[model samples]
Target: MGHDTVETPNLSFGRGATPDRSTPYARYVRLDELHSLQHPRSKEPAELSFIVTTQVMELLFDLLRHEWTIARQALREDDLPAALAALRRGTHAQDVLVDSWDLLATMTPQEFNSFRSLFGEASGFQSAAFLHLEFLLGNKNAALLAMYDGMPGTQAGLTEALRAPSLYDEALALLARRGLLPPQEASEQRYRPSEEVAAAWRRVYTEPESATLRPLGEALLDVAERVTRWRQRHLSAVKRTMGGKPGSGGSSGLTWLRKSAEQDVFPELWTIRDGL
Candidate 1:
């Protein structure tokens, strides 16, 4: 399976808009255009931090999605080394994403309130890039497409991601090829934990004969752990800034975030722990 990197059609950064290529630093990274993107809505100093942190997260989301796409394709081809390398790169990026919350973690409620109303109805929940990252992690929700009905191109790309087999799907399929058949189609199931799947993993951990699968299992667990940590930190940051207030774009704020943090990404890998 050939992999293609997702294109950011909305950004004007790299489409022949960059300066002369003679100076590698400015041209190669589009530093001038990147710095020009920050336009804070309010006069409050805290708003600048909010805008920059959110934009940073969007960039990290794209980076992680790119790595996961490669990992998914590599797994489909049964290329273990390739898949592991991509997964390793994604985990490193994930750690940076998880830490990005620190930039906004210290914002006092007064400081946040000072600028919160300036950007009315805008929400991080509407980020297409974050949604793409979730879809790659096997957390597909078709209903999210409605939010982007106004933007057909973005919706189409997300639709492709939602329908396609995710990185976890490929991992489970690889295990099944080696005789650990999961109970259902991994692509369709939404975090459905199967005892059969757990037992298969138990064998991978306990039975030395199944040693080849251990690295993959551990790599997946690493991803799940980092994602959970990210959500937890996000929830904490929200609670610190807004408490139980309603979220922007009509979400339930802390209530919604708490639920997201509790949700497990890779189920059987955790369920097999007691046996191990």
Candidate 2:
């Protein structure tokens, strides 16, 4: 029998080897680099917790985007089962994202302020990863392109995401292919709820031939619901810690988040529920 082998990710940390028994696993996982990235600007007890939670959420945002991209391509190929699987995995990741708020939920306003100023103009609003995930979910905003003008690669990637078909767009294209709606095209503009889309979803719920799309609809709703839950949790956490204070990076904090939380991720899916 022949064995196949593949190269592994470089684990060179320049430490050579250490006495710790877990060095092998730690090196493989790059735990040293991961742990070192958490630098607390303040000696305050809660600052490290804040930084770690933020980093964890950012990493999860990248994971969620990867899964959604796969699902979007799967939908484009009319691979319903593949898309559903990716969406389901995405929802589970979203659930974890929502739960991440637990780490910061108890942070008092004083504790937050202790290190808030240290962060200066930096803000989560500036996370390209989160913005990319938003675009993948069909919440495009061309105005955001200016935010990354200094970073060419980031700007170009965002531009592509802004122009490419989102997961929801591809899902609608799948429905159109089944003759549920007229042909669809990718739109860079933020998705607005359309009566046609709502009616198509309504038919998916009631029509016998549309049975195959039912699970996909339900899976999308799952993803949408988790999105809402995550945003609401973020708002709750921020309000608890900042109390309407202006966010870093010139954002309006609660006002902006409140509007975001109120906007349903899949607007048509939510509206279709009423008639179903």
Candidate 3:
């Protein structure tokens, strides 16, 4: 009797194997390119986390801006369903943004100190997408526009955002169209919550079953709550990492964020809540 040695066939299931494009799972997410973007300036392992977290937050901010734009436009067209959908998606993205701070929150002051110098003169305060989001939410400040003057794309986009009606502004106009708010004002200035607008929101809250108004009011409230949570989380992250230290942008870190957080997204929404 002779013993025979058998060779096993090479199974093409490993990394070198060609991907089958026909399969649904075979489609590329371009994650190879996405994952390649995290180039931390320092050798510190914590620096990678810091950079990645900030980048992730920026991506979330972009998504939020996109959703809010749709929501604002929907409100302008008097399309409640479209506006509600956009608001709901923005709320979900806001949840992600709030949770992302947890990653940075875990960093001790010592860990942050390693890469803090690498971020010289750069801060979250200079986030253009964030500024645009603020503008879209009616927190417009002309001073912030100066930061983007060098970048034409960013400057142009932010300029347009500032000139356009804010989400709350569109909502208020919709209310006016429905006779819930007073007639639209003639001025095209930045939308400030008028006493009449606040009164209308109060009515919507008081009468919760008023067909279209109640849900719209609640949707706006949900967005406001999520936005507040994001701002608070951001302030807390800054405090946790840097304490009372000045921000990279030369402003007081936590102090500035706290003040910004205090400014409500939809002022009338919160103002009406107190009366309810």
Candidate 1, residues 37-141, lDDT tens digits: the string is 999887889899899999999999999988999999999999999999999999999999999999998999999999888889999999999999888888888
* lDDT, candidate 2, 153-229, per-residue tens: 99999999999998999999999999999987789999988899989989999999999899999999999999999
Error of 2 at 84 (Å): 0.7
Badly placed stretches (over 4 Å) of model 2 are: 1-22
| Highest-TM-score candidate | 2
Q: lDDT of each prediction vs. the true structure? A: 0.88, 0.92, 0.82
Q: Which candidate is the best by lDDT?
A: 2
Report the C-alpha lDDT of model 3 over 1-276, residue by residue, as the tens digit. 498879975556788887443434333666656788998888888998887888899999999989999998898888899999999998999999889988888888888888888878998889898888878877777777898878989898888887777888888888888778777642224457678778888777776545558888888889888888888998888888879999988998878889978877778777776777
lDDT of 2 at 226: 92
TM-score of each: 0.90, 0.92, 0.86
| Deviation (Å) of 29 in candidate 2 | 1.0
- Return model 1's CA RMSD, one decimal: 8.2
Q: How high a TM-score does candidate 2 get?
A: 0.92
